[model samples]
Target chain A: MIQVENLTKHFGPVRAVDGIDFHVGEGEVVGFLGPNGAGKSTTIRMLTCFLPPTAGSARVAGYDIYRDSLQVRSQVGYLPETVPLYPEMRVREFLRFRAALKGVSPRKARNARVEEVMDLCGVREVARKLVGHISRGYRQRVGLAEALVAEPPILILDEPTSGLDPNQRRKVKDLVRRLGEKRTVLFSSHILAEVEQVCSRVIIIHQGRIVGEGTREELVHRLAGGRRLLVQADGPAAELQAFVGGLPGCSEPRITGSQGDFTRVEASLEGEEDPRVRIYTWARERGKLLKELALAEPTLEEIFARLTLSPAFQEGEAGEEESP
Target chain B: MKRVLVVALRELLAFFLSPMAYVIGFLFVFFRGWETLALAKSFADSGQDLNAFPMLYAMGLCGQMMAVLAPPLLTMRLFAEEKRTGSLELLMTAPVKDWEVVLGKWAASLVFFMVLWAPTVLLLLLLQAPWLLGAHLAAGPIFTVHLWVLLAGGLFLAVGLFCSSLTQNQLIASISALVIINLLLWGPFIVARAGWVPAEGIWRELFSQVYILDHIQSSFGLGLIDTAHVWFYLSTTALFLFLTVRSVESRRWV
Candidate 1:
């Protein structure tokens, strides 16, 4: 559970995180999506109490980040953009140190916690190996394991899957999904597809401002009006364009390309009717062959780009003007 | 206290595990032992009494050496290593209080320094046993000198740890610590010779006699514990430890 109110962080002339507010309820998996220099990491650091907010306040796990930072930190597990690790320490030793640092009581429980997190993060195999000697993927897992050592109720991970391979990325995503089932998990990433796959809700930020925040479908619908159809035919390009363009309620069809026997046409349609049916009927009567006809919906990536680039989504207008 | 012990134990274990601690210990013992023996031999040849002053002087030098060398090795990794490797965030975000982390790191370096002194105890015991076995050995005075040396060494270690906390570069930390300790050790003589301060004044008293070496020499060389000297070492240690804590706390704001 986290509540951020008008949070802003300014570094001299640059506002890294402008006045923006958002909340993630308990057990919710929220993904923070932004391109490079979108102030996502700065936001994460502020929420974690690692950096003092130049203005505004954030309460993490019901504790004020500024007034009760220690409590907030105790309850929230943070994995910074670059997970800092002591290379000389063994995996178990490092985890043990973190356990002690977090003030986890009872000697037996500490040991159990170390073992539990080691297994939970799939780091049991390299428990005895030196942290420095491990691979990047394993090191990231160790970082996550350290965060989970105390079993904090909330997790704030900055680019958790940044440097992992495909398999490792999948593993991390699965781990986050599983963890999010019981705890509040807020992870930041620039990879749209990764966030789409694991995050239930997404918040898109750009230039120190929140540009868009919603479910995938809501965001797509809000940014992209509706779906359109892409059609390619085996006929003269001009004839196909004129035929599709003459259809009522259809915008002028743009001839995409004509290579040998195929001519591709892109048109903006008005309603939800299957444009393929109309195209097929027209092609049959016109003695033309239809090569491909498919409906194309806007993706999360396109929505993200549009929202971030929109003039209304500037930093000063972040929380003042809500977009859908 | 338990957190402090945890950190101290890890630091001590790391010191022993690495070659740096052994190398420093061997060098300390070898050089200090050679200097003490050589001085004793010269005194014996000259038919002078076996005074403890030369031994105190040698120990003071050893204290300065430990002060200059041990800290960078022990402390360079205190905050700098964490910042470099990103473990500092883990420590800072943990439930532990800022003071706990600071004290833990300080205690760790102190324990390591104490272990470095453990071998020197053998030298003291050897020097005491030979004279104690014979009549009129005056073991109390010799032991008193040894305690003074240990106190001075502890003060140096504390100052070194404080300096180490100021920077992340090992070399920079070590060099700055060396310069500071050297200034503190040689400051009295420089001030006394400069004659800039008026004689029989507070300025002269503060600058000429404020250094640790003079205070330590008066107590250990004379085989007496001056409350002022004890207080001086304790207060200096407290001041540096406090500074270390502040330096560490300020890092979070950055």
Candidate 2:
């Protein structure tokens, strides 16, 4: 579990992480989405107690990050962005060292935990290879095993799949997804699709502040404004626009695409309701056949763009997309 | 304490695996053996006071130069390499205190320092064997030499670790350690020998206090255990290690 309140960090003249607030519950996988230099790494560093917040505070696993850093560190596993590993150490040796460093008690237990996490991250095959000699994908897996060696209840991984191949990326996503079922995972990534596929809730950050935070559907629906409707009808484009304009709770009808037999128009309802029934009755009365009519929500990519680029968002709409 | 031991053991493991440790060791032994044999040959030919071990203590001056060279080699990679490679983040974020990391690293380097000098223990045995074989010799000089060697070795390692902690560049760390160790070891000797200041009064005492050559010869050269000299070496070790811890902690904040 994690709770942050107005968390801020400034590096001299640069505000690496501006005032921000968010929470992550147990067993929830939260994706921290941001472009490079967007303070995502800075935020994770503060949570992991690697960097002291210049202002505000945070708590991880119920322990204050500033005051109880050791306890927080012990409770959460961290994988840094570059995965700093001792190049000369073998994969298994490094994990064992990490296990011991994380306070996995007793030699036997530490070794067993190292073995388990190696298997979990699928690094068993390269256990004896020097970390420097291993491929990038295998090295990333080794980093994951190191993070999981202590069996911490929470994992804070900064770009876990940054340099991996597509196959490796998919494998890491699957691992994160499976791990999230039993542990809290907060992983940062610039890849929107990775965040979408692996995270239940996403936190979008830009310019050192949180621009948006919510589930995918919530963000999409909030930005999409009203229920988006796509109507394809067997009629002229101008007639379809007229029909949409004449119907109640319908306006802004514009034909987006057209075929020989049907024309497609994108329209939306005016209020918290659908206009399918009104459109259907109006179509029957007008002697017009409706080919298709469906409500659609905005995509995560579009919502992300709108949230990060909009002038309203720039003025600070922090936590504006949280679910009601 | 347990965490410190874990880190320290890991540090030792890394040092043993590194080539720098062995290279420095070989050089120390090679040069040290040459110096020791020359001392023995001088005593044998001149038929001077054998018990005084003037040449042995003189060889200690050579050992001290080696001390300056050896520690920087062993210590260059301690903190500097960690920072360069970024593993320092892992070490700092682990459930270990800043003091523990500094102390652990210093302790490991000190251990390697001792290992580099461990071969000298055999040399001491061979040199002292004459007494064991019934030749007339005093054990006092042997004990004194060992004492000065231990104290001076510790001071060198501490200085070396402190230099290592100041930068992420290993070459810079090594070079800085060399300069600092030389200044500390021979700075007073240079000033005293240059004859720029009064030979008597408080300045002489001040010079003797820092003149490692004087400290080694005054306390152990005469077989006297001066608590002040002991305190000097011990306090210097503590001071540098404390500074190293502060340097490491400031790194986390910045």
What are the DockQ scores of the candidates, in order?
A: 0.55, 0.59
Model 2 iRMS (Å) reads 1.6
- What does candidate 2's lDDT look like per residue over A132-211, in tens digits? 89999998889888888888999999999999999999999999999999999998998989999999999989889888
Misplaced by over 4 Å in model 1 are A233-252, A259-262, A268-290, A307-324, B53-60, B129-137, B196-209, B252-254
True contacts kept of each: 0.66, 0.57
CA error at residue A269 for candidate 1, angstroms: 6.0
Write down the lDDT that model 1 would get.
0.76
lDDT, candidate 2, B1-254, per-residue tens? 88788888889989888887888788778888878877776776777777567425545656766667788888888999998888888788788898988888888888878888789778767766663323455667667767777787788888888888889998999899889888887787787778865868998666677777777667777677788788888988899888888888885564
Error of 1 at A250 (Å): 6.0
Q: What level of docking quality does candidate 1 show? A: medium
Q: Give the total clashing residue pairs for model 1.
A: 3
- Give the docking tier of candidate 2: medium
> Scored by CA lDDT, what does every candidate get?
0.76, 0.83
**Count of steric clashes across candidates, in order:** 3, 0
TM-score of chain B of each: 0.85, 0.90
